[model samples]
Target chain A: MPPRPNQCSQLSGDDYAESGRRAPAVQIDDVVVEKGRVRILDGISFTIPAGSITGLLGPSGSGKTTLMRTIVGVQAVRSGTVNVLGRTAGSAALRSSVGYVTQAPSVYGDLTVRENANYFATVLGRGRAEAERAIADVNLTHEADRLVGRMSGGQRSRASLACALLAKPELLVLDEPTVGQDPVLRRELWSQFRALADAGTTVLVSSHVMDEAARCDRLLLVRDGALLAEGTPAALCAAARTNDFEDVFLRLIDAADQKAAA
Target chain B: MLLVVPSSLLTLVYSMFHNQPGRFDHIGLTLLAVFPFLTMFLITSVSMLRERTSGTLERLFTLPIGKLDLIVGYATAFSGAAILQAGIAGLVAYQLLGLDTAGSPALVVIIALSTAILGVACGLLCSAFARTEFQAVQFLPVVVLPQLLLCGLFVPIDGMATWLGHVADVLPLTHAVSALDAVGSSSDPTAAMWQDLGIVLAFAVGALAAGAATLRRRAA
Candidate 1:
């Protein structure tokens, strides 16, 4: 059987703290990513602390997805480096240790929800029972036998999430996972992300929604391929002298524009 | 089902017009040579493109699975379907259409299977270059059509221009058709037939390797 959350203290506390002190779950240093002639992520640097939820907050096309892809080792970087779990990003050794969910639902359409999850679990060297647990965690046990293609948009995304959850990866990178989801489902999913983080999994969730930023342990507010600020939501709001994250974000962007002008 | 109906109908019509004792054998050999290649190529390319467009391939790339595992898995799965299709086509040609050949029937079946496997390999290679299903189908005309025209399916390779004959020699389908023709004419598989089969298999392996090399985690 897979180790329960409580039993996985090695992932949570002492070792995690030691590791956190030495190295983060993910580290991006002077990273630059370009698509064609356009620079997508320009000289970005950040470290995600282990055993916490880090929200990557940005407007659409602000390079949030590109940054997440770089972290997962799928995106090509023109220069600089991304290190994940103490290895170079996209290294074969980190494959099992990292789980990623793209913005779009990425589950196999021909396979049932359970089958898709099981296949990924098997690929990650986990067994079928873990797949069942993942499906249940995503609250898709009722639709386990249903084909992913036939599922509703929300359910299909959940199925994709379930697939990523199967390996119980140490680092989970979700790109707009709660997009198009209802409020209750979104709340449940946030709780699930928190629960995973509480169990020692480092969750890096990207979103364009500012309200969700409050739920994160730290927020990396980005705009136009640059990070405007990185801090806890409350800290960021206090620094900007505003409680509204949206206002804070705007103020930061304005500050960046003025700095560039100067 | 979709491929067999039209091909079998065409064979029936051609045989009725020819009206010779051994004409069905020629038609059968041609269909066996071409149908499996065309069907498997179209099916594999489209299915792989579907996987890419649907995001499954991207998701799979993030896992611990290697590129070889994916390419081989696709090849193995489609090869099973290819075998089944070849079997059904062979049964229809030999039993239903009364194809008469001096060569071993088993050799013909093996040749059909080889063509199907070649199709799978070539399709996979082509899929790596395609972004959409339409683009994948476009390869049928740009890639497969040229091979079909020059594969010695219509004019004999010996009768073609010297340069065209050299082109045919390099085309994998040319060797496939040559092997089928050899098996159809001779009582035993010849050294030439074995050589042609070897080249066809080598082409399949090479194409598969190329496909693996070019496989991307995401569509560009």
Candidate 2:
């Protein structure tokens, strides 16, 4: 069972998960992000432990994507620090150690799958064999020679993932990675996630999928840039005294809304 | 695929001045005659415009690569065909025109390459300021066309509208044409060519800095 936010805090950071360091792989301390004068991430703070799988669960417009971009150094932190891999997100070494798979597939439409992979490898300093292995890992080897534009949506997502994994990053951030994937493929991908965590790679995934939220080692429930609740799916359910993660997710969202209104 | 821009430049030069234009005067004047610089402008600016239009600019910002690498990579990649076009133009000029060739042929090739770089730099600066490919293209007549019209190519530099002539004197290509004209005539190489090279380098560096700033703003 997952611990309540406060309860989880009590469990010495190391005891919370298999993650090695007490310091987080990603740490956001009082981050406030804005886009064109509109606040997107409003003084939010959280720490994702190394080697743990942390799922960011939120309703739409909850600033999930904004937060993820901040962690990857693409979005500026209006105020506060974002530390990843023991350095600021903007640090070159940290950039190399962190791989990001954005919501949109970043593959070039005109390039073949293999060409796309090769381009990434060349730019990211990955070896050919490693790139091929990543393709194989994502089960994209069969589609390697096909143009990215012609591939199915799910295959494009898989190719995007393979490209992200090519760098063999220690901290991987995936935003709604399984969006267009089939149920079986989702299951297979989560299994791969588990393997990645087992190998000591910290993973941060953002998703609205409730069942998927239940599978993550921990969850950060957010709404309107504020942390609504933080715990494992089971712990949240226990706190709400319900077995359903969806119900727990909803109740917390409602509670946060009510509090904000008051 | 990306070779279209350079090939067009070569074709424009060939179509305009039929029968090989020999001698530096004929080749240089002929190149200056057609609007080849416009093609170079489009080639250098279009790629950056495409990146922004396709949402790939944001994607590129998320990568680990340095800003310098991005600038240099795109510039170097586009330079290959630009050099090829210059070579073909020179060869065609040699065969078609009966101008006597003097001095190291390699020096001419170097000058041609430097000129291409100047053109690319100008295009890059335009791309830096433009939000879309169309906006960049609009700059063609206002920015590049004047360089051709007033840079002492067709009309003597002294004969143009006084202010236009002054503006043309400051143009980067004006110095380049001065150098080429001198080289073609096998006369004393004017200091104007060195000045043109210096000005082109300045423009290239300024454009690169502007590009880096734009990229930084986007990332932020």
TM-score of chain A of each: 0.90, 0.92
* Candidate 2, B47-97: lDDT as tens digits: 777666554555556667777787788778766766676666556555553
| Best model per DockQ | 1
* Model 1 C-alpha lDDT per residue in residues B1-220, reported as the tens digit of each score: 8446635664665567475666556656766877778888998999988877787787788888989899889888888887777777777777776677779888887887888889998898898789899899999998788888887766778999999999889998989888988988899889999999999999999998887777775422
Model 1 regions lying over 4 Å from their true place = A1-22, B2-18, B217-220
Q: Mind sharing the TM-score for model 2? A: 0.86
Question: What does DockQ give for each predicted structure?
Answer: 0.52, 0.34
Q: How would the docking of model 2 be graded?
A: acceptable
Model 2 chain A: worst 10 consecutive residues (lDDT sum):
A6-15
**lDDT against the true structure, each candidate:** 0.83, 0.73
lDDT of 2 by residue, A1-262 (tens): 7763323233222334546445678888999888887888888888888788889999899899888888888787789888888888867676667888878887787788888888888888778898899899888898899998899989988888898888888999899999989988898999898789878888999998877876688889888887788876567777777656678787887876787799
Clash-forming residue pairs, model 2: B20-B96, B20-B97, B22-B97, B23-B99, B24-B184
